[model samples]
Target: MKFTPVSGSSALIGAVLALVSSTSNAADLAAAEARARGHIAAESARTMHDAQHSYAARDVIIDDDGTEHVRFDRQYKGLRVIGGDLVVHSHADGRFKGNSQTLAKSLRLSTQHKIKASEARAAAVAAHGGEAQKVSEKVIYARGDSPVLAWEVRVNKAQADGTPSELHVIVDAASGAVLESWDDIHTAAANGTGTGYFSGNVALTTDLVSGTYYLRDPSRGNTYTTNMSNGTTGNGTVFTDADNVWANGLLSNTATIGVDAQYGTAVTWDYYKNVHGRNGIANNGVGAYNRVHYSSGYNNAYWSDTCFCMTYGDGDGTTFNPFDSLDVAGHEMTHGVTSRTANLTYSGQSGGLNEATSDIFGTMVEYYAANANDAPDYKIGEKLYKSGTGALRYMYSPNLDGSSADCYYSTIANLDVHYSSGVANHFFFLLAEGTAGAGMPTSKTCITGNKLKATGTASLTGIGRSPAAKIWYRALTVYMTSSTTFKGARTATLKAATDLYGTGSTQYNAVAAAWSAVLVN
Candidate 1:
């Protein structure tokens, strides 16, 4: 019942062709992209050789006042440069506000590499014990001071315990050594066949080919669900029905779990599309697919950016339940959201933020759906418990889990990214609901204490959940970098608040107070 240990950066690392597609914001975004492109081209040409550096537009944002921010992925020569991502900022009147990038050094690394692609793949497979599916050279700055020409090798394999793994190994092309490696499986933690057992009776759109209904949503970019047949590999068969109605919420039926997964996927898609204006996971109209009943008794769920899909598992019947619940679905899919925006490195504070982002959005998706069968709450995996009590993690007070920290400390980064997420979770709770109001979720952590204010007040104020969510969404899409830390989050949220509600607004002050309550400052 835990979503720990996997980092999703490698899954999203590559050439990204993200452009805002909403018709309302289309013309404004195009102009913003053009201005930012000119700035990037001028800077690169003036500084690094004639044209050694280039950038591809990823995401664009234009505030109500016409202030704009454009995100880009940097390229050295033809190779994608990891951590060389930058955001182009401009004022409402179109004056440049300079570029915001994490890469501090000049881009002048030699693209030539001594190691052969075969050799790099061999080394990667030897280390991880898997077939080499892909091996490409890239310039990586996320791991070191100077940009490194490294081999991005993806080994197709599963962990020893049968957990599906796409081990992405970064090998130094010069040193022929492993730079870093992480599993690409973004798990939420597990299923059956059949309208959903968990989501209540819901409406669904299916493709009717020759009167046979295919389990696909044509409206939401043909988003579909498949049965994994309890296998650890393959894309599986897409669910089809003789009748338009899929199934009742019955685990005995093979597609019973698929119904829940299908319902969950659609809800998450609607949440992002309507609430945050994200067209899809990548801000394109395309939808990420879902796979349910994965690998017999596999108690987990995950989103794979490489496959652009979500996978679910049936609980072992002891610790967890089928992980096709609404919030869990939203949690896993938000990893895809993080992949597209910010691309937060899956280590240290950045990784914690990545996990926290999923939790925050996942919880919001629950509230957004307002599902009657499943009540909205701050507890993740609350409904997925086999015992039907307790939760995977408590957002109001992370320390309730014994591992997650409710307060930020210098060494908090030493913990797993999942546990380190506690502080941000606490901050978000305070930002959305205030200091544990009567009858609201209570915690035995710092929020209940007087640490939030200098005056030793026991209570902290909150802006409503919707406004808080909007601020976080804006901060994530516009200001956050791959390496943003807790302190950096404070700056980003304040900026987002100012952009949305103005500098001296109540929402702006609430963001500051929430961070202060969590000791981020």
Candidate 2:
């Protein structure tokens, strides 16, 4: 994704380049910024009746052709509007061209509150199926034929399954109607240690803050780990010790699991930096923190974009060990990366791509680490199984798991994202390793119960992991967009392969063949 500098516009090019260079800070888009504000004011007058409705510039991008795109965050009555964001496109002469908005209609709503804030909080808690531990309310523009005055109530509590909860509920301020609700916790029902369940015996990196050493890596953006102390929520205590050495084989010694988590985090960090040129999860050069032993007998781990952190569970300690295995950590952390980048929504086919992206990188990270005890394989959560004989997902043959779809179909979009992820997962395996019987892994078969074969008469040849991973990473970061579908993914990967290996090259052909093999065409 290289952009050529426009000749005679070195100053403007430098400004645009600076804006696109770092994801850490907002770009100082001076020229575009000024035009964007005026555009917003004019649009606000036409769309929103009240003077209270306004917009603040969130991002500005100036294309090489002299077009400017300004993204704005909307506010109503000085309060943030949840889904009122829009993007304004302008020409170089500061002339308004067009705008894209999430809102379906104009913002005109009654500001008078018929429902008390306390009542709205209670309604939110009731909708969340739990007692409210904490609740916050704000005015928001609720989407409909006409935007309506709504109280956006956020409730935090424990779920029925003992998982920590963060639910957002929208209640109509005048009618006290529950307009919408959503859970913030992203859990994938599935870590660490003095002796990690999979990493075997390992040494850990620590930060010596004061006289005590803590489970913090000073090298990787000061990445740190903490013990959740078997609770579901809140920032856990940072693991500290008089001696730098921590974690033993005993499951009782939770610090041992922290060792596995910390090690996994380090390896994942290294994989992104060394392979994909990503500095960290958000490409901000700042590391994310980890929390282990979340909740008693918790069976799932999750990544929270709100906190910019990852959480691991101890499992039931029977059916599963800790959820801090290297691949698991990679999987979870990749979720954060996806959120920061192509943020594929967590449902339907896009969600499947989201999960497959994580799974793909998770496998790559595992192989990159090359840990002897946890031999790398195209299997997700292979180490988390209590029996230690089965895997949660099989990339070589997704149907072996009995839930994941091995090939694409019209109905594949209807399956759960985790299950639908099989399509891309299998495509990736085929792209990297070719067919199972054709000289890659053993005992691999296609969704049709036949030997996996390439599309058309072209015989599939292995392109190896490095090229495949690079292609996928490039597609993910450069070509993929928020609403990219499987078909769009095919286009993205093809473009990526072309960029990396050139058009009509062996790698490019392999990418096309792989997608066809998975029935993505």
Candidate 3:
């Protein structure tokens, strides 16, 4: 091979241009953040925030006409405040328009401690019931009926089956009481498709370093897949090849699985950027890495915010195959998106919305791929099973899963988030495909105390998949909060439709009717 080098002047010009571009982005973010801080200062003077609270900008969204939305995290008296995050919306000229927040009141709690840090750690350890591995502790003001002093404890442990038990336990700093605890590890399991190991033979953009081609996507945020070698811990090696070509579409080559993950991640990246104008998973033009062959006979896949990456499992072969399907990739990556945007609390109605958001986007990614070998459908994790019909959940009619609710119910919040997600899934399906499409019920009957039983002549008319997805994405990023409910989702999506289309437009009406069909009102 022969190569020609650019002249010194050309190379210097290229370097200077790259430097200017990088500096411009940083300067833009800094200016917007300054404007947000000014707005926040005005609000604090007006008592919307406490004088002791400090705001740090995490994200910035600039509209076509220059309107800005700045997302911020809060701290008080040198202690982090959980659930104290908020978004500030401003006019093109930096005038504060309004804000999106769940903090109904300003922080007024005293930052005093009655219990020792060791005692709080002990309480967290006892509540989690795992080996005492104290990762870190932050004295945080946790949100509840009111903000209270607490210790946000991190614990590291593993379940017997190799699943992570990285627990985030909240212990009351004043009483040493275990207030709340949740696993940081979120699992999305059981589904994917087609010939050539889930995704068909496809093109990939890889990294060529020192005469070796590696499965790293340089185009899409540098997302690369690694080989775990079936180990239970740590990021494994990045797959490399002398020739750019990869596996022969079988398990005989581990890179086959890597191909599936790589393709999935790439397709998902393109879907979000092209469809919604999102730059990347975190909307920062950076990619999340992937790990294939995680643990021996593991049957699950997950996205860890702490690591900012996607991890896939090689199934036991009885229930699922390797979880590297395109939808699986989309689903897992959406979890990261959810964490970065709304940071939806992973419990109750919001948790279900979180899961459903992944399912909805994953299905969209599958369709976006338009793979000839793999057919598209509105089923969650269906492709993982030996039997094609064994989907983890159904969207058009979630009740077919036996546990998921097809309509909103009073106790829906008490169900597991995976099952409760049925309501949103059903709503999205009706909004996109309506009650009379492929694999859909011609008449969807629901009376779970929602008054109107939408069926027969009252069935909803779908606007289209593109509009429906755009509305949902708008709602998710621009309107929904950490603790949004089904009713709130209805409102958010309605507003989103109005913003995208117009008030009382067909798309807006369809969004309303779809929510009504699912009994979210």
Tens digits of per-residue lDDT for model 1, 1-521? 11112122332122333365664366677677777766665566332323555556777877666677888776666677767778888865758766656676777668888888888899898887979876455555454667789988878887544567776688888888987666667665322111122887888878999888999999998899998888867898999999788788777887778888888888999999898888888878898898888887676788787788998888765666677889889998899999888988776788789889999999999999998999898988888875566777788888767677787777777777888888889889989888766557654335334322222245776787899999999889888877788988899999889988999999999898888777777
Per-residue CA lDDT of model 2 for 1-521, tens digit only, reads 01122222221122232233242234446667667666666665543424556555544545555766665556665566665655567876878876645465666555677888888888877766666545455576544445677777767776656767666678888877887654556665452112225577776778897799988888898899989898765889999989887867677787878888889899999999888767788766789999998888887778787787889988876777888888889998998887665555565677789889999999999999889989898988878867767777888777777778877777676787888888899889988887743445642334443322212333456688899999998777655644467887998899779867899999999899888777777
- For candidate 1, the TM-score is 0.86
Off by over 4 Å in 2: 1-160, 165-183, 191-196, 437-459
Task: Report the lDDT of model 1 for residue 211.
Answer: 82
Candidate 1 contains a number of clashing pairs equal to 12
The whole-model lDDT of each prediction reads 0.76, 0.72, 0.76
Better of 1 and 3 by TM-score: 3
Q: Candidate 3, 454: how far from true, in Å?
A: 9.6
Q: Which ten residues in a row have the lowest lDDT in candidate 3?
A: 11-20
